[model samples]
Target chain A: MEFILQNLNAQTGSFLAILGAAFGFFLAAMGSSKGVGLAGEAAAGVVSEDPGKFVPCMVLQAMPSTQAIYGFIITIMILGKINANLSLEHGFILLFAALPIGFVGFLSAIYQGRVAAAGINMVAKRPEEMVKGIILASMVEVFAIFALLISILLINNVG
Target chain B: MSKKNETNFLYAVAKIKAIENRLLDKSKIERMLDAYTPEDALKVITEADYGYSVSEVSDAHIYEVLLEEEMQKTIKLLSDISPQKEIFDIFMQKNDYHNVKVLLKAEFLGIEKDENLVETGAIELRKMKMSVKERSFIDFPPILRQAINDSLDTFGRTNDPQSIDLILDQACYKQMLESAKSLNNDFVTGLVKALIDTVNIKMFMRLRALKKNWDFAQRVLLKGGSIDTDVYINNLESPVDSVIELLRYTSYGNVCESGIEDFKNTGSVAALEKLCDNYIMGYVKKAKYLSMGMAPLIAYYVAKETEIKNVRIVMTGKINKLPNEQIKERLRDLYV
Candidate 1:
């Protein structure tokens, strides 16, 4: 009975760590997909009218993709710590570590997408204002970066 | 596929924003007005998107043809690009109603006035003509068909052509209001109401100038305006000063003050018409700030119409060899 309980704990601990990585990756990736999709729609509208504006629109549409990268970095760091002997306590800590990035990255990407889309429309009307739009879109990335920092710090303390 | 963004007009609005730069403005019109010859004035418009190839330009006298083609092109562009096309019905239906009026009048009077029919209505001119000729109302909107029947019955009894204008004009507003309400959009609804008020004001002043009876004016007045119908009715017998006083506090105060003064002084609705156009332009200028939805498209349409009207005014003055100041005085405000 003792050996079986120990085996179950080992399996659950590994499962929990992998689940945290999955949450961090998929949630943020889904947000990026949403963000890119929204900005892409507005970008296509601009490009259709004036193909010369394709470069600026392309830059604006790419702004939301960084959140996914942040989530991915945390996800990889969590996975690097995985092993057969990982305790349930460490599993819970890893899971908690993933939560901030998962939630923040997901929301920030979607909201950033909305801003980028609006910016793309602005750039269409006044092509010279493309820099202003890019700067506005990057503001949403700050919170996402902070979440990534805390997530990495938590993963480092898992030992 | 994922549900599309809530801003369904994103594509159309963005394209229109780019296209709007090509619209004629004050300086463009000034160039046309200041040009030495009629053809030179024509040259000014040719540079804009009047939907005419340079080879198609035959003569300045036929600038009307160019204007007509541009109107058709504008209608096609809006209908083709807009996702919420039904919202435009409120505007395009005016042409449909105009076509019906022309066909009905021609049938009644046995006159050949084909030039009165335009090709730019929401419904095709041919369709409206056939429906009017055959007495079929199936293809028409509910209020419009009923207006036709009512106008026909009233004409049969009274043998008056003016009744047709009254019934059709009122029905036009009713149909416009219906379409506006169905959209549930505040901007469009407010625009339609403003239009009704302006039309009512114009009709009241004209009927007053003609010395028409109060009862006739009341009957002809449209139902859906911000101002009450009785305001016109009660003031029908009063002098123009009291009417001006009554409307002084309304949003149309400037229009009434200037339009009524011009009407009283010159006995021409020309100034009044110009002021009303500018007032509507003022109303639509609000759409310039909006980056989404159908506001910009509608604003562009109004802007183009005003541009076309000014072009016609300039061309007429140029051909007649009138002074530039006179042409400038007659010109409506520019949208850009």
Candidate 2:
């Protein structure tokens, strides 16, 4: 454990900053992929029977993808904070900032995908009721949005 | 029951949801019941997308062929989508048992293949026939092979065909319970238990009506139902009213009570049979809200079967010129 800690300490601040940005982007993207994939499967079934429903089905499938974009923005912000004089403490703070969105976005996106997949059923049965289904699925995104907001706030406050 | 298997049903469940809208509602059934003639009834059915031609509808055999074809198509669709085919195989197992009864009876009567044999069983009708003819069950599952042997032995000893049905019915429920348990699904298990209870109740009522002895009732009653065997045995000597009172605390008490009343008024057991089917449909109707899982799939299959049964009842009633009210009384509840 001491050896690992000493090695981590020996690494440059840019390396740690890069690691934080990678975590934020990769974890959120993975979560979004899972969520969208599940919703896409359901949408394909609906569209197979009725091709006209492709638009609404696609909308539901795309709802979980926002987390990935949020993750990408956090990644860009973390990269911007990396400098030649970047200290270990500031790099660690950025890493901690990335953790909130990375973990929360990952979990919430998957659950939201489940909700969106269920919503696809609603759209399949009642096309006019697609708005209601979208609203219900969007309810799961509140936590992911909060995490993104906190991530941005934390990265912005990093000196 | 891995996570992958659970998630694999999303597409199938979505497709089922869309298809569920096409199921016959009460209003359509009422329209069919209101039709004045068989041809008019056929028109109602054909217009509802049952895919039967006028001539096919006119011929009773052809109509049955169409219904069986539709049932096969539905089963095939489910089997194609399901990660675990055994869940649907449980439903097909009933048809296998039905074929067993037919084959055993045919063999005992020294007859050729019976045309009444349904071909939708998990085991093909031809293979089952071959197994019965050769007196070997090499290709059959253990539970089914044992059932065939036991039924044939009982028939051989007593030379009574009725024992075949009794023995096979018990074996069928036992196998269904085993299948449900293997899937580790609570909903399917509960549905099978309800089915066993209904079968037991139907048998009890029939035996009671016949003034049969306790030993005979004991022989016909099935185990693995929610009701205790002793309850049925003790109630054998009692009147139907006492039996109803005893069942009042059970899950199916109300259905049993209404069935008894209908039996009294009509002097026919058909009303009770309809109630039993409706009870099962009512139980599975709860799965409609489930977004993903085997429950909705199982429920959809049951609903489709119920729809076919109702269509058959209506078509037969129309051909026989039975009264509308009588036909209406016999129709089980529609899933929609």
Candidate 3:
């Protein structure tokens, strides 16, 4: 792929880096949206019956958005790494760097959303257990944090 | 295939979980049972948000009115929230078939029995009655249409009301199985099969008591249950104890044991009916752990149905001045 990109244009290094940023931003955001959609649907169901539960339900529903934030941070890092003299190898490195958060954030957020939705159901049944449900849903965020850490290290190593 | 359908009921399932809190518990059942008057017993259910508002119904004696109102409300709410509206057709279809039977019997006897008809069904009651009366079923489901025709033809030959019941009951299960298969859901199909099995088991026991012949038993036992005809057909002449022993290892072993033991002692089928209902309730209790699926919705429906039935039992027992133990024996398990 690098060879093909190089042959197509002698100077495609920064373009690849920009592509990496797009991947990190878009894939993670898409995942976060889907996660939020699922959790939001469940939250609405709970809140419909008991309006007082809106706060707890909202907390659980918003848990998946951290994946999008991770994606955003990686996108910014990739954009910062771009320069006129950036080599094609370095461009490839940045593109590969974006992948850890892009793919992982995408999948993790969706799965985390499902967990949060279940948590919302738990809160609906026993309001006192809202904290327990939030803690359970937070377990899924550990993987997203690992993906974010890997993406940060890879971006730092891009030089 | 069913995995995909499981995700569709998320909203309804979660909402049902919330609504489940209002369902009667053991304490509530006890309160209803111990109420001083039948009107006070009626108060227990009315306070739980059952049926139409209390203001609309002036008399407590019309408990059937409140029960019917609750059923209609539950069906409407579930259908409105469900992604697939016809998901509820399996339960509602039974009412339609029942209405059909009542209408057909009335026609055969040259009498009108509107009071015996249940108000809730997938099809409008009036339309179903008119269609049955006119022998026009173009808009009706094909299985039901054919079943009605077969029942008419069979009745013509036998000149017996029993044949009409046998034909309709068989068709009810056949159509339930068909609809469950159409949904491509094992949970639903299994539920329908379990229902058929209970009915088959109860009918077989009743037939054995009556010393019914092989042909009659075959006609009475409906198809589509996991248990085959041979199980009942083979044991037609066996003594009641041995029949229960033979069925000792099946899934229904406990049910048959408890139900038959009760039958042996009381010489009445009422306890068997309660045991069969308990068996179904036990089957549906699996849905409690499921957070997102059609199982919870189905469970909720069964739970509400059981709740209504238990309340009816308590109301009747209290009204008749029966003892508490009798009422407790008749009560089904609580869903909560």
Clashing pairs in 1: none
CA shift of B63, model 3, Å: 0.9
Ranking by TM-score: 3, 2, 1
lDDT of 1: 0.87
* Candidate 1 per-residue lDDT over residues B201-233, each given as its tens digit: 998998898888988888888888899889998
Kindly report the fnat of each predicted structure, to 2 decimals. Answer: 0.47, 0.59, 0.55
How well is each residue in A16-79 modelled by candidate 1, as lDDT tens digits? 9999999998899999998888788778877887899999999999999998999899889999
TM-score of 3: 0.96
Cα RMSD to native, each candidate? 2.9, 2.8, 2.2
Pairs of residues clashing in candidate 2: none
Best by TM-score: 3
Question: Against the true structure, candidate 2 has what lDDT?
Answer: 0.85
lDDT of 3 by residue, B1-336 (tens): 365566677788888888888889999899987888898888888888888766676567898888989999999889888898876789999998999999999989999899989878888998998898789999999889898999999899989987889889889889888888887777778899999989988888888788999998888898989889789999999888998998889899999998999888888889899889999999999888787888788889999999999988888888889999999988998888
Better candidate by TM-score, 1 or 3: 3
RMSD of 1: 2.9
Better of 1 and 2 by lDDT: 1
